[model samples]
Target: MLPRLRHAAVVAALVCALCCAPAGATYSIVACDAAGDCGAAVATHNLAVGASVIYAQAKVGAVATQFETNPQYGPKGLALLARGVAPADALQRLLEEDGGFDGGDIGERQVGLVDARGRAATHTGAAAQASAWAGARSGEGFAVQGNGLASAEVLEAMAEAYRGGRGDLSERLMAALRAGQRAGGQRIGAMSAALRVATVAGGFQDIDLRVDAAADPVADLARLDDQFHAHQAMLGAERAARSGDAAAARAQRNEALRLSHQWDRIWRRAARLAMQLGEDERALEYLGVFASANPVWAREEVDDALYARLRQRPQFVRLREGLGAQEPGG
Candidate 1:
């Protein structure tokens, strides 16, 4: 009877441990962009569980809390900043209030925040995984923190990468994430990643990407970032075309095409823009590229509304027919 009682007690303890433990081991960076926008990005080893780990309110601040994460801390910290609390003071309030839960084991939490003014703060709990080498670092415009990392060098590498990289806040944040991965990522690797940037307008200004699950989340995130830039270039081309700047439109479209050769949509858009500019040879070239990349467009005789001007061109017809011939039933 005594042995059975002991066994039941042990089982209950294990169940409680499993139920109460948060799922993710995470690394994150928060920053203020050159244009004074603020944002945050985080990567974690739990599928879809860390989306809320990083939070930002445009022109207010950004926050990321992890380790034995209490996601509520993210919003609460940001709200504190929104009310004019200093970054350090806001972090203190979070640490103080965090004591009301989980038997006051605030030492198990890690957090980082950057205010709209570029003030930064970070904290790492003593109770984080020993193998993780948990740590935090802060600089002029950024804060980086991590737990369940292979070494403390991971934290330093991220900070250095962000400080040294050029371009916008999103680019620097991505550099930091890649640096952490190269230095030695989380002990179990990552499954989900997210990047968000906010401007004074309170929306995604530059980037807002999420990878819910992937074998290599950081690498996949880099790919997504490239795709984002390609799309942005395409939009710039369209805007230039609408403004009647043919040279600028052509340059932007060519840049988009250079960035993402696999993106069939860019080829199609480039063809339409060329047609609008009356560059018939360039239009035919783009159409041929699009048809070669997207066989279905040719097989179904699908014509874009913008391509009406080119519908009767012998070169365009030949390109479409050539593409159709590659289909099984053609």
Candidate 2:
């Protein structure tokens, strides 16, 4: 009898434990490192319902966010709540309580968060506007945003992206947010322009880039796409240069340099590396670009050995003579 009672007690305890657990509050956070060329950006969009989807690009430091609400919270409020707050506590405090949102149209909306821990959370609020909003935690170190999203759904997507295949946190989060947007965004079809939130290590870029509020949101977002591609070009150039493949080295270096003349430094580095690998022709091409971009620097770095190698080629000799004749003081 004692054993039977103990077993029954255990069963009851297990049931109680399961019941006591909080119903899976939908929320998530992501760990982001902006070690890439463009640094990082947090882009969010509005979705249907009183929910907002959120994502961010973290570069150099850890970032995290917790979403909670007795009711739903918009992306903006969730972002505010996520600042420097623990995931579980932040969600509980934000959601379990009442009276968080006041007179705002998005008072009762769901919210999601991303932070350094790479965990996420969600809270569904009462009925409210299917609006979108965003925020950066502080010091341009982080950013948060969302629009017309289901709190739980948004958080789920965020977790999926954070845990999904690696490469480009900002791109992953943006893709996730876009997925959420497709399901149902902001109860409207691109009523206003979209925004872009980015974090850079030493660049002048800011936390947000918003469109004119009247243009096509998708088109607006696409306009900023060039910067990301430029970044990819930079990475590809560095990789190809390292591999000592003359064709790839020349192609990537030239492409990168064409995209951003500031990348002349990268081209020069690639040129020198190409020379070391016996790809003198490719190196010379790169040197030409470098010389054209920064003549003074080129003159100082040109080596007699390099000149001798180039002189062996009639075309190179003619090119050298032409360059010398075209110089300002020559």
Question: Candidate 2: lDDT over CA atoms?
Answer: 0.42
Query: All candidates' TM-scores?
Result: 0.82, 0.42
* Clashes in predicted model 2: 40
lDDT of candidate 2 over 21-90, digit per residue (tens):
2221112223344342122222332221112222344332222222223233233333543465654355
Off by over 4 Å in 2: 1-41, 44-85, 91-110, 115-118, 123-145, 148-162, 168-171, 174-265, 285-308, 311-329
Clashing residue pairs in candidate 1, if any?
Answer: none
The TM-score leader among the candidates is: 1
Worst-scoring 10-residue span by lDDT in model 1:
1-10
lDDT of 2 at 131: 27
Candidate 1 structure quality by residue, lDDT tens digits, 67-134: 77778788899899999999988887787677536553455667898988889887665455333466
The local lDDT score (0 to 100) that residue 299 gets in candidate 1 is 45
